[model samples]
Structure formats: structure tokens, C-alpha cells
Target: MRPQTTLRRLAEMKAARDPIVMVTAYDYPTARIAERAEVDMVLVGDSGAQVVLGHDSTVSVTVDEMLVLAAAVRRGVRSAFVVCDVPFGSTEVSDEQAVATAVRFVKGAGADAVKLEGGGAQRLSRIRAIVAAGIPVVGHVGLTPQTAVALGGMRAQGRTTESADRFVREALAVQEAGASAIVIEAVPAEVVDVVLPQLHVPVIGIGAGPADGQVLVLHDLLGITEGKTAVFVKRFAAVGDAMLAGVTAYAAEVRSGAFPAAEHGYPASADAIAAAAAAAAAAAALEPGQIAD
Candidate 1:
């Protein structure tokens, strides 16, 4: 087996200019795929609210829901560093609440680190609290889905001058608060480039362009999600089409009675067949009102 990826290894990769690969995985199968693909990080992202659980937004996902997903991903991963998203409301109330939430992910889900969205003052305090509690943290800045409504919807951040300045400040604050790594999403590449020189930790870009690493939702990359996706998402495989085709073929076969053909079944011994025949005969001989022995 390959050696498990560690924070030290990730740091080395950043120093060596090796792009860290991360993917969000919600369950065992997806996590197993990520492990087999040799990804550097596996995120049990709150995006599971929309991707897996059919919720409309990330905020709807609770800490308990995230924990279940994180634990499942943990069971399927052995090599990649696993980070669980501390869902909205879990950490927003108070620093103590944030620490408790982080503890749950570490103790219950085996998360190597917990990721928190936003880099505002409260968020920085929460990051500090979680880190002080002995849990590593990955900070998220730019277009945080948890508070998209407040940011004027899920759109690209750092596009305006003021927005760009805020983005830079937040990203730096998050790093200063002791985040082991950071994820920058939906920000202009130019903005990210300016901050790259300043951030010492690994910076994983989603829609923010190249940095120390990149991450994408597994479903998005695998073509499992329908309709339009974000501009940054690039589908690497048509797994959804393949799945549909397989299921369509099965349904057609089932409807036409083409499935469960003679060769599809197990063969019984001659003695077993004879015993079944005798049992049928005995049943047929039973009186209408009598029970068989």
C-alpha cells in the first residue's frame, strides 16, 4: 500500500510546485474512486447538500448530515488527507460552537482537518478556536456557498476593485488565523495570483485558477450532475451517460424477458430436482381442507 498523504507531504508538494489534487466525495464509492485516482485530498464537502441529498443549497446541510458523509468517506479513504466541511450554522454561532463542531469531525469522522467557509472576523476567530483545539483547518474564501445570499448570490468574487481588496484581505486573515491550507473559489485568477506570493500554505483553487493545487466536485468532473454547472467545471468523463445507458439496457431486457436467461441461473442437482418434483406431487395430493405434514 502507498504511504498515506500527510500535511508534511502536502507542504513539500507546494514547495516543489506540485499541484495538489483534491475532489469532493460524499460516500464510500466516490471516496474509493478518489483514493484509487491518487488524489492528494478528499473533501467531505457541504456541497453534498445539493449534489447528493437534493437540497437546494449548502446551508441546508447540518453538521450531523456532514458527519455521516465524512465518516463514510473516511471508511473508503486510506491514503489521501481527508477534510470535512463544518457546515453552516455549526460554526457561525460562537467560537465554542465551532470548536465543538470541529471536534465532532475529528473524533467521529477521522477528518485530518476541517474546512470553514469565509474569512471574516468571526470566521477567523472560529478558525483560531478550532486550531487551538488541536484540529487543523482549511480556510475558504471568495464566493462561499454557505453565505451566497449575503454576497448577492453564487457568483464570481473579486471581480470589482472593492471585492478584490476584500478577497485579498480575507484570504490573508484566514492564513494568519492558522489555517493549514486554503481553498479559493470563484475568484478572478489575477486576484489569486497576487495573493499566491503571500500565502505560505497550500492554496487549492476551484474556480480561482491555478495555484498550489486545484479541486472540483467529483460529480461535476464525472458528468454525474445534470443541467448547467459552474463555468469553471470541466467534465472529464461521461459517467452519467454510461450509467443511463447501462440502466436503460437492463430495463429493456427486463421488459422483454431477455434477462435471467437459462445460463443466468444456477443448476440444481438431479436429486434436488427430483426432490422438488416429489414435493410438488405431495402438495397436489393434499386434501382441500387438510394441511400437509
Candidate 2:
């Protein structure tokens, strides 16, 4: 089944019991290619600040930077829903300020929706304001990276009964406040499982698997990012290994002078050779005093 209208397709996928597969995409080529390859959603994630520009975390990504990538991804993607993050500190402003900033992602960046970190903490009124303004929102919860300093590293959330209940409450509130979807990240599968049955909107998982669908960091899945994937993250492709093999082969051929074989070498051209000899004579074998002798 084709997941076309981001929300429509997400709902359809949920009904079909097919897990949605969303991936982070920062630019046009990746977005268009992913949409053509038929992925459900293209997330212009602020992670670009890390993966592309070598930032420390999503926090360091500016709203301007996110919009730049979002627009690029928007131009590339068609059919699948394109969502952009509000980036850090953009939504913590007034309700009017939040909507105004989110509008930039849609109008300036061509995103279909905006995603904001944190569900229950500080400014849920802003989420409602944006949705009320007719912009779709994808709520993020359970280990929001925008709050990483407070969250304290990559730890599983909702481990305790109270925390679990809080996670559920936040998820439900976000959905009720009109989030088209929710991204459960870096949380236990149990947290995902508990929420899946409870929410009407589709649950797109990152570290959470087999929920309504799943999402991943594009670089990690493609093995372009150098590191081991988490236990929760599954590998559909070994892009890193494949890339290594490809580069290794190319390097060896180049070093051994085995590359640029007969076919790759320039075809012998009599005109080209004659032109080169004329250039060589002009450059070398000069009569030292010919100009004034």
C-alpha cells in the first residue's frame, strides 16, 4: 500500500497493521529518493545539525538552519508527508510566537507539518495554538533531545510506574491536543506497546519498534554514521560495510596504478597530440635571446 498523504497514509498503514517506516532526510535528493522508494514520511530532523554540520546535539541547531534543511527536503519530497522540527527554543515562546515560528517551516520551508519536542512540559498551549491554526503537528515525547541536558544522556525513560504513567498522560494529551502523530524515541518497547493501543493517532517509533510503525536515523541505517546501533535499532541495510568495501577497492586500484585502464584512459587524438606539442614548444626549448638577438 502506498502511504501518500502523510496523515492519511499513516492512518491507513495503522489500519493495515503495517508499521510505518519514517527516516530522517535533510536535503532534496534524499527526500525525493525516499518518497519515490515509497517511505511514509520524510523528517527534516534537526539532527542535521549534528550529522551534517558536526554539532554536539539538536540543541545547537538554529531555527534558521532547520528551516533551510526543511525547505531543501520539501523541494525534494513529493507524496510522502514532510515534517520539520521547530528546533530548540522556538516553541518555548508565546503561543503567538510558536505559531509564527512554525509558520516559517510550512510557508518558508514547504513542510507539511511541524514537530516540537516535549509533550507535557512547558507550553503545550503552544501545541494547541499551532494545531488550531491549521498546521499539523507531530508530537515528540519520551527522551526529547531538546531537553538532553536535563534528560541526562541516552537513557530509557518511563522505567518506573510513575514515570510510565506520566509518559502515557503526555502521549494522550498531545494526541488530544491535535497531534497527527507521535514519535516515541529512546524509550522502552513496553512504553510504546502501552501507548499504541491507547492512542487513535499512529505511533511512529524510533527506538520503539513494532508499534504503529518505525523510524530511524538515515545515516545510522545506511551505515554512513560511524558507530554501533542501539539494541532497539534494527538494521535493514549494512551501508557502512558496503561503503567501506567500495572505497577500499577504489583506493587499492588507484594506489596500485591499476585504475584508469585502457577504456578509462583518454582516446588517442592526433589533433589533441599536435596541439599539446605546440603548447610544449611554447613552454619549453625556448631560445634564450630570440626576442632581441
Candidate 3:
């Protein structure tokens, strides 16, 4: 109902009636489209590692690469709060190192905020430190791709009573650590159902539903892959299919010498064209001495 600050607006939307609609957009064009469509948040997610770089998981992306995409997304997005992910291995060192990496999103890539995995684990101190350094933090809880190796492969989390309770506690810990929002991913629906009302900060869900907000990997939503779409994702348009069809048609036309007809080329009055060409040649041949000084 009121004018919203970038990430703070997530808090407002959570407070108000409408649930925030967020999405992951790794590049400039996708960011521009999402911003124009009035998405509340746009994340330059390292899921680009999977979709763009052809990595099997998000593990291969680096902070520097994410920063590059984040800066480009920042330049493209005008309205939505743009959040960038801190990639795998970027924060393994220390708090100061985390703050330094976070600074690249601000000073280098121009992101409004940064998202990182873990809440009370190795990431808690770093989350606080980054916030203390005046950087907004988005805490990622429940399931983190950066820990794919440790997680023993991709699987849904919080099936057990203890794991569910731990997930809720970690969500609170992240909120306590000064995260403006928490990205709730790959957790049980019931767990999210309970935590959503309890969290003071906004919750952006991936697999979890009807949270304070929701986020989907853009590639999944765009139908960019013929392989598989995540269960939680919905395809809003068939952009990938249409683009491939269009490209294939163009290639066929080029191969068959059916494109570029005369009508598609230079169409001008012969006398005017001759005059223009002559004038262009005369201008090119002229020297300082031949000019009217």
C-alpha cells in the first residue's frame, strides 16, 4: 500500500495482504523483464552454475562469477530489489573475508543485498559481520546447494521431527542474525506452514508454498530446458521453445538461400543514391587545402 524500499518492501509485503512474488534471474534481459513485470525481488542466483554453466549442481559457481552476473542484473533491474548469492567456497575463511566478499556485490556488482547458505552453522558469524559492515543479508535455510557434497546428494529436508524443529530454530537464528529475509528451500510444507507465521523477517520459499514470498529459478519458469522442471516451479511462458523454433527456421532459410530478398536490402531512388555515393566519395577525397578555409 505504501512506497517500498528495496529489500524492506519484502517485510512490508509480508505484513500486508499480498504475498511477495520473487524469482531468480541471472542476466540483464531476464532482470529487465522481471522488474517490468513488477516482481518484488530478483535474485542473481548461482543456480546459473546449473543452468548456464551446465554444472550438475550449484557447487561449481564462484563468488567472482556471481558478482559478474549480479552487476549485470543490477544494471538491468530498475525497480525490484536485486539480491545476489554468495557462491560456494566464498565464505569458508572468516568473518572479515565474508564482509569483503559481500562488498564486491555492493561496490562491484551493485546488488541491493546478498544471500548465503546456513544460519547457525559456520555462516552465523559471517552473516552478522556482513550486516555489521552495513550490508543487507538474506539467510538461506532448510536446504543449501552449497552443501550438496555434505548433504549426501540432493534430497528434501525436515522429514523427521527433530530435523523439522532444527529447521525452524535455524530460521529464527538467521532472523536473529540480522538477515532481512530468509530463503526457505526444499523443506516440508508443514514446516514452512508453521514457520511462516512465526518469522519476523520475510520468507521466500522455493519448494515450500504460499510463504511470505516465493522464488523460482528463472530457467525452470521459462521452460528453457527440455529435460526436467522442478516440481515447485511453474512455466509462465514457452520462451525457450519459441526461440529454438525461430532459430531453426532462420538457419534453414540461410542454408536454402531463401532469406535476404531485394526488398530486404537497399531500396532507394537511383538518382538520389548516386548523388549520395558521389558526395560521400568527394568528402573522403578532400584535403585541407581543397576545402574552403
Q: What is candidate 1's CA lDDT for residue 217?
A: 96
Per-model TM-score, in order, reads 0.96, 0.87, 0.88
Per-residue lDDT of candidate 2, residues 123-180 (tens digit): 4788899999999999988878888667677676788787688778888888888899
Question: What tens digits encode model 3's per-residue C-alpha lDDT throughout 1-293?
Answer: 22434665666678885788888887888888888788888889999988877877787888777877888788888778888898877887999889999998889998889898986667889899999999999999888888856655566777888778888899998988889999988897887888777788888888977787789988888888668776777898898999999999999988999896677897789999999998888877888668622
Cand. 1 Cα-lDDT: 0.95
What order do candidates take by TM-score, descending?
1, 3, 2
Q: Pull out the clashing pairs in model 2.
A: 20-213
Question: Each prediction's Cα lDDT score?
Answer: 0.95, 0.82, 0.83
The better candidate by lDDT, 2 or 3, is 3
* Candidate 1 displacement at residue 72 in angstroms: 1.3
- Preferred candidate (TM-score higher): 1 or 3: 1
Task: Give the top-scoring candidate (lDDT).
Answer: 1
Cα-based lDDT at residue 48, candidate 2 = 89
Candidate 2 runs further than 4 Å off: 1-3, 283-293
